[model samples]
Target chain A: MSRTGFQLPLLPGRSPSEPPDTQDRTRALEAKGASEQVGARVRRLFGGSFHLRHVDAGSCNACESELKALANPYYDLHRLGIFIEPSPRHADGLIVTGPITLPMREPLLRTYEAMPEPRLVIAVGTCACTGGIFAGSELVAGPLERLLPVDVYIPGCPPSPLTLLHGLLLALGRVEEARR
Target chain B: MQLTWLWRGLRTGVLTTRYPRRPERMPDGWRGTAVLQRDQCVVEGAPPSCVTVCLPRALSVEETGGDRRLRLDHAACIACGLCVAACPRGALSISNEFELAASSRARLISEHRPKGDRAA
Candidate 1:
């Protein structure tokens, strides 16, 4: 199989799409906005490589699928010099999905604090953007904006890979965000 | 040998979108975010009918100043088209403008000014 080309035969055993978890209807809210200074900081710090840490505070994992799709041949975000980092300590950006639940709040903030300065926080998906439909629930401590300064808001039940790309680029200050 | 893969690659063109450089668009009739056709809205009652059908509370009637307006919050909407189907006036329709990322929550909301009315 050519690594450059997508092969249909690969990963035949990957699990089917999971339904949205009603009980875990992640509740979070959008919080703060970053100054233009943050964008300049990102451009300087990342240079050509953007390292990100993804935090799933309380999502149904749909956004995770789209984030995974970025690695595939179709989206291929890696070619743009963007990467997902496992440790927050090494990241320049934090991309969060799902509504921040009660249990995840401390850890989410801890992860945010763990990152070095000039950190960019991107709220991915409806839940992290607006508390989404899960806004009224008692279980959520989110809209990520409530917790941290969100530099980009990618609002979707789950954002598409292309939308995710747009958000990432917006965070990098390479593209203009398309407001509704 | 490796030639098969090259042949396959040749057959399949570049799959990546022109996004960032060019805006991506969904196909026509693609059900994405829903918007209220303000000019066509014939709000007859205290609350618009679409509010009841919207499961996520994405649609709501807001009273501002002296005017009553319908607010559509895209982030809360699932694009299920229930509001489109439920509206008797066909005032609600699905839009393909799905590149709805914004820097703030307020940008995701659009308050429509109704043009017509059906009074009780």
Candidate 2:
């Protein structure tokens, strides 16, 4: 079997690419300039970074998978100065995923209590944000906000990595437009 | 360990997305945020199909003083697109937008007037 003509030629341009004469990058940068200002504010507030403690209240693990992807090479949250801490005491923010299960409620509260002052809570996914499909379940305690103050809410069955990044940035008071 | 691998890495260039700079490109047929078009729906003549098909209870039809309206709760939504497909009049659909983050939960709740009533 032959695998010819399946791929395009690599580097069709001349050796050592030259910058385009058109100002396309500037327009692209302008559209995202608001986020840059927000980044500056975030840096001023948190010293350019923040540590997070993620708690799986009671989810199907779908959200967890997406959250874990933030650390992967694709997202590389570390490049943005965001780190996930193992302990709540060392965390500047708390990222709660899934619905609040009955048994996990107390532990979740305790974890929140352990965090330092001026802490922020980000509710991730539909379940953690509003109980999702299991809203009325007797085994679950509903959304995380019922038990604690939620600073940011990320909505989706399992929000994409980009959405989560926006949520984190939103929590940092970096949102451009008011709401979606 | 080989020179070819280094060349390949250089050719691949940057993999990081230009998101927040340029919006992330959603996949083809991507379903993110769902919206309801009240003007397109026939709420008085037919039952709301979107409500019945929405497993998450994110879409609800509530009666308020002889008027029925649609309520879309962003928090409870999983973006399943089931409700969008169930709408007979094309009243509900998945939008390309994915930026659904908000500081206040109440801001995520949106209500639409029924077809028979004036849109608010």
Candidate 3:
């Protein structure tokens, strides 16, 4: 048997023929003018000052696990001047994970609508950015861009903690400065 | 950022799975698939315990004249390990061998019975 070509069966009730353009337009709109706004806010919140909020739409828990790992002693996201807030009102950015399942669409919209203006949205994991292997499933409503504007995207089956941190830093414009 | 990059580089080596080529290692107590021992099966009309434990109705027992027959549907199995535990005669065990890939789904089904053990 050829293991190289095996793929899990597509989730039930998914369309195999949907155009990819829908996702692209949404992503482009999200990326525009987002970095600049987030960068300004992050600059003011340096040194243990900013808080982030996380939402799990319908992920398999892999992405959420990695996100929580950031808070562990080894990663210590707090040391980088970042913290995860429980509420949208108190948050500067929204970290979203999962494939945005059908049942979660309304709740996700409600969460995004509640956040204050100049708020940044970061889509983490392949499930968030492209819905990964779940894209066409009836249970999933999106690649996230379909419902909410995404400022940054970090891709992986479930991205490593550092990859997520780098994405957050990119959104903050901290990595660019550090690059030079 | 240089410090972050150095830390990231060190961590990247540890992530990802080398699956497909090598048999993927499942977690402890992972239910792979059930194997049937033909020798332990009774050729008589005695009911097999595997039939009762399969939640998905993936297994069936048949009687041909006087022989007992057991059939299994591999695809319908969720690898729940119930049948393995239910086999009272030690005719069934759950094996770690998961590479049951087939070009056709029909090939995945399996049947077990003692050879030349005619039904009464």
Candidate 4:
């Protein structure tokens, strides 16, 4: 069977400790079919695909850098049927980074309000989840969850590119999971 | 040309990580998260053993009626290897568990009771 649309660059479903099998074609075929079905369902949820608008809510720029790396050849998040969009109006999801400061509170809400129905809010990095080291600050107003309905909370100082991919996949799973 | 780049791509195999779908191990000595080896912990000292040395305060000890419980908040942790080095009994060390994404706030906090106090 040919998997034409399957382009998950990361070696999913295979353990590194296990030696590579050259004669396990049947087992490999079954695994591929399962992940492909999941991919197809996820694609249908957003009507072919969806766009994400990332907002830096007064972050230290570390999360932003990791977010930027997703588009590069190494990570390549676009291959997974999701994209980084420029406009909130065109986006179906929001990837928020850093602790939301007083100045960013109004803009963040405006961006969330701009998105259409079935919108997803993903809080990336430690600051965005629980404000990390910047919790209970005088200038800060949010940890992303307090202001919006966050679907996923990726807790890391600056989550690695792969972690962001996993979070996006989890959010996609949630959309389908909720409907069921 | 685009064709030349395409040829270069075929030469260089896939480099993306396989995490979440499958476990990915971080490099040796890589500080992903702090772990408190409770069995090795000498609970004879006053409460808040390694909590004072923690820079982010991810480690904390709450003494409720003489029972000291060391709490490690993964959300607040910055992955700094301070607590591992600061432990006088050498009970703390770094582990390769970096995929710590969660949907709720309370799930991120973990508690470790010393050998004798297992009630709480």
What clash count goes with each model? Answer: 9, 0, 3, 0
Question: DockQ ranking from best to worst?
Answer: 1, 2, 4, 3
**How do the residues A100-155 of candidate 1 rate in per-residue lDDT, one tens digit apiece?**
88878767877876787667788998888878878968888877776677777887
Error of 2 at A134 (Å): 0.9
Clashing pairs in 2: none
- State chain A's TM-score for model 3: 0.77
Please provide TM-scores, in order, for all candidate models, with all chains considered together: 0.81, 0.81, 0.49, 0.75
Question: Cα miss at A110, model 3 (Å)?
Answer: 0.6
Off by over 4 Å in 2: A1-41, A177-180, B1-5, B45-47, B118-120
Cα lDDT computed for each candidate against the true fold? 0.76, 0.75, 0.65, 0.70
In Å, residue A3's CA in model 2 sits off its true spot by 66
Tens digit per residue, CA lDDT, model 4, B11-78 = 98677754444566667875556777768875545644578777667888877896777888876777
Model 4 steric clash pairs: none
Candidate 3, A136-179: lDDT as tens digits: 77878877767666776665446656656667776776653111
Evaluated on chain B only, candidate 3 has a TM-score of: 0.74
Q: When only chain A is evaluated, what TM-score does every model earn? A: 0.76, 0.74, 0.77, 0.72
DockQ of each: 0.44, 0.42, 0.01, 0.22
Off by over 4 Å in 3: A1-32, A44-48, A177-180, B1-120
What is the C-alpha lDDT profile of model 4 across A111-167, one tens digit per residue? 866776556778998898878778888778767766676766777777777666767
Give the Cα error of residue A132 in candidate 1, in Å: 2.1
